[model samples]
Target: MSKTILITGVGKRVGFYLAQHLSKSGYQVIGTYRTPRPELQQLEALEVQLLQCDFYDIQQTEQLIAKIKANNSSLRGIIHNASDWLPDSDSACSISTIEKMIRIHASTPYALNLALAPLLQNNPLQFSDIIHITDYVVDKGSKKHAAYAASKAALQNLTLSFAAKYAPKIKVNSIAPAMLMFNPDDDDNYKTKALNKALIKQEGGEAEALRAVNYLLDSGYTTGQTLKIDGGRHLV
Candidate 1:
């Protein structure tokens, strides 16, 4: 049987593309989306098992973990690709918003890894991988989305810690992308401003991110690393 992979936040964008990529690549994919979207509807057409879990809701998050435990699915990898990317002003990034960001990004990944270790541990392949979808702001900081950036930074740090603890049995890593996808509502001026951060003068879309995921899954010796597919945007 092909390896089983779980990718969270598959309603659209990178998570959506990654699910299609993995399913096409022959891995059995299980996707989680907070709400149904057209992309997820397509995934369902491809037979990707879909689960609804709003990580912002503690009860729903707990229930998702329970569902995983009940399935006892032989999962080979999990990609933490969920986030709340609402535009936040100084007044908007309230304590509750910050807490939700932390919970959705850091707390959920930690819980899933801890809860699912046993399935990965006992796998006949003897190894498993976990990938977190982080962002470029985690490298350079963000004024507008400080809460989101800070929470992702925490997740990046956890990637290091968990990679060590799970070593020889599981590998933990992250992919930090810059402008992986621009909001369709973004105007030409906004796109220009966003592209200015990249030395490559262009955005690397879901394809680059997918490449990193495939590498992490197939590379035997890589762990505890963050693959920044940011078009060298961190240089600035």
Candidate 2:
């Protein structure tokens, strides 16, 4: 039987790419989305199962997990890629924004692990993994994105905590990425600045992010760690 993986916020961008890559690589993918996106519909047509659930809604989140449990006794892995990015504005830098960011980025994942822990532990197949998708800015903090940085930092901590508590069963890890996707319209100077921030001196791509995921999946001895896929951006 093919292994099954669940990826939250798989309606577009990096989430969509991950779902596509995993599906093509032979894993059965269960992708969740808040609203219907055409690209996600395309994914479903390509054989990916779509589950609509808002992670920000605690009750709905729990219900979604319950449904997953009823349908499958085991899950190979979970990629927590859904995040709510507050606008980079003065008003969005307030406590209210921090609260919302925490709810979506940190609190929701914590609650999810709590609700799914039992199911994960009971996995008759016994080889499940949890991968949190965090931003590289969490390492060096962003001036205009304080809340975003803090939320991802909390997520990193959650990854470590889960790994310690559920060791040797469900391996928990994270990927900290920097500029995995760049705007095509961005000018040369803008791209140059981004490149200069990394020791690798290059912008990252979707393929690099997918490779990071594969690394975590294939490494049996790795857990409780965050892999940086930022072209060495943390060095700067």
Candidate 3:
């Protein structure tokens, strides 16, 4: 395997953890972050290549593509973990809220995959991978987060198209997760309510997502499909 992976939105949460974990595991990890954060230094210590690009900006996204192309000859995988969660009800929300959400969740990934598809071809493992980190609300939709849900739904749809387009050379799939982790500011009551929505009834943590990503990377026949890591939330 090439052992080189690119991940986006690696400043915090799952993105940061994934980058750190993969880097420690001896992968050449290239990651992008919208902002500079202190925790990113941890990734630097692990020798992960870091880039700064705001997916909301088209020029920046284009520049990011150019940078990756100029620097790397080949890539083993690209994990589309960059995301934004803007609800329609927020005071900051406006008509462009949906546009911004789509740009981050759907448009940026669309552009990156199209541009980077060539680099993923001809891998030693016989295939490269593209994994979209989508959300559970993509199926049911959301009242307060209507725009957010719709954007994620669009991302999931892209998995089907890209999977068909890329075929045997590259596997395209998505991982839709629900309540995998809670924010640091979440209160006890809020945590309880969120945990109650899933049958597993516990915070699955970032390790759960790591497991899902590893499974797809190791699989030989799974593509154009979604591996849901939602702790059986739909059955509840």
Top TM-score prediction, candidate number: 3
What are the lDDT figures for the candidates, one per model?
0.86, 0.85, 0.92
Model 3, TM vs. native: 0.97
Rank the models by TM-score, top first: 3, 1, 2
Clashes of each: 0, 0, 0
Model 1 misplacement above 4 A: 89-93
TM-scores for all candidates: the values are 0.95, 0.91, 0.97
Quality of model 2 by C-alpha lDDT? 0.85
Candidate 1 least-lDDT 10 residues: 85-94
lDDT string for model 2 (44-71, tens) is: 8779989999876788888998898788
- Residue lDDT tens for model 1, 1-236: 32888899999888899999899988888899998776677898888889999998889988988887787557888899988875455564487778888899899998888888887776668679989888888977887788899999999998999899999889999998888778889999999988897888787878998899999999899999989888877686
Best by lDDT: 3
lDDT of 3 by residue, 1-236 (tens): 38889999999999999999988888899999999999999999999999999998899999999999998878999999998888696565566999999999999999999999888984576889999999999989999889999999999999999999999889999999999888989999999889889899998889999999999998999999999999889998
Candidate 3 clashes between residue pairs 3 or more apart in a chain or in different chains:
none
Error of 1 at 68 (Å): 1.4
lDDT of 2 at 211: 94
